[model samples]
Target: MRVGLYPGTFDPITIGHIDIIRRATALVDRLVIGVAINRDKGPMFSLEERVAMLEAEIAPLQQETGVEIVAHPFENLLIDCAHDVGAGLIIRGLRAVADFEYEYQMVGMNRALDSSVETVFLMADLKHQAIASKLVKEIARLGGDVSKFVTPAVCDALYKRLGR
Candidate 1:
């Protein structure tokens, strides 16, 4: 089976992420959503919460696309995580040219670590291109409406987390 790993913090799993995950299903039989446990970023949601959010958001997509989707949490290197998930392909979502520069370096480093694994970039839908998790959290924290950027469930979670 063709398995792909899509790694991210997924603090709240924005619509942009959903768009990528939905599109990524077409490329792999099994899509592993790697929820990174990066303590350095000080994410708004815990690893468990992030994983749960991802699971909730992708459930319908999995059903719709008939692609097995699993949420896997990893604190190790992304390349190592891909190996652990048996992913020969690493899927990444690109929002802009700035994202490509960083992803380019990452792809190079990951290739050096494991030449067998390949990285594929999927550009975000134009509507969601500007929707980032960080910005979503910022808007939510400031009492702004985030319904357009996230699912109703995620929006509710963000508000509940922020005590709004």
Candidate 2:
């Protein structure tokens, strides 16, 4: 089976993420959503919460696409996480040129570490391209509506987290 790893902090899974995941399902039989446990970032949501949010958001996509979608939390290197998940492909979502600059360096480093695994970039839908998890959290924290960026469930979780 062709397995792919899509790694991210996923503090709160945004619609943009869902769009990439939905499109990525077509490329792999199983898509592992790697929820990174990067303490350096000081994410708004815990690893458990992030995993739960990813699970909740992708369940319907899995059902619709008939692709096995699983959430795997990892604190180790992303390349190592890909190997752990048996992913020969690493899927990344690109929002803009800024994202490409960072991802380009990551792809090079990951390739240097493991030549066998490949990285694929999917462009976010134009409407959702500007929707980022950090921005979503910021808007939510400032008492702004984030319904357009995230699902109702995630929006609720963000608000509950911010005590809004």
Candidate 3:
């Protein structure tokens, strides 16, 4: 089976993320959404919280696409996570050229780490192209309505986390 790994912080999964996950399902037999804890950035939700939210948000989509979706929490390198999940490909979502340079370097490093794992980039849908987790959290933190960016559950979680 062609298994793909889509790893991200997913502090809160946004519609853009949903778009990528939905699109990626068509390419792989099983897609594992690896939610890694990025110690570099302070996230709004805990790892457990993020995993629960991801599972909740993806449940319906899993039924719709018929592609097995699993959320995993990883603390080590991304390549290791891919290996653990038996992923032959690493799926990444690209929003614009600005995201290219960074992701390009990441692909190179990931390749160097594991030559067996190939990287695939999927452009975000136009409607969600501008949405980002950081921006979504920022907007929500400042009391801006982010209902359109994230799901209702995530929106409520964000507000609750921010003590709004």
TM-score of each: 0.99, 0.99, 0.97
**How well is each residue in 51-73 modelled by candidate 3, as lDDT tens digits?**
99999988998999999999989
Residue 32 displacement in candidate 1 (angstroms): 0.2
Off by over 4 Å in 2: none
Give me the overall lDDT of model 1. Answer: 0.95
TM-score result, candidate 2: 0.99
lDDT of each: 0.95, 0.95, 0.94
Candidate 1, 1-164: lDDT as tens digits: 99999999998899999999999999999999999999999999999999998998899998899999999999999999999999999999999999999999999999999999999999999999899999999999999999999999999999999998
State how far residue 14 of model 3 sits from its true place (Å).
0.3
Model 3, residue pairs in steric clash: none
lDDT of 1 at 143: 91
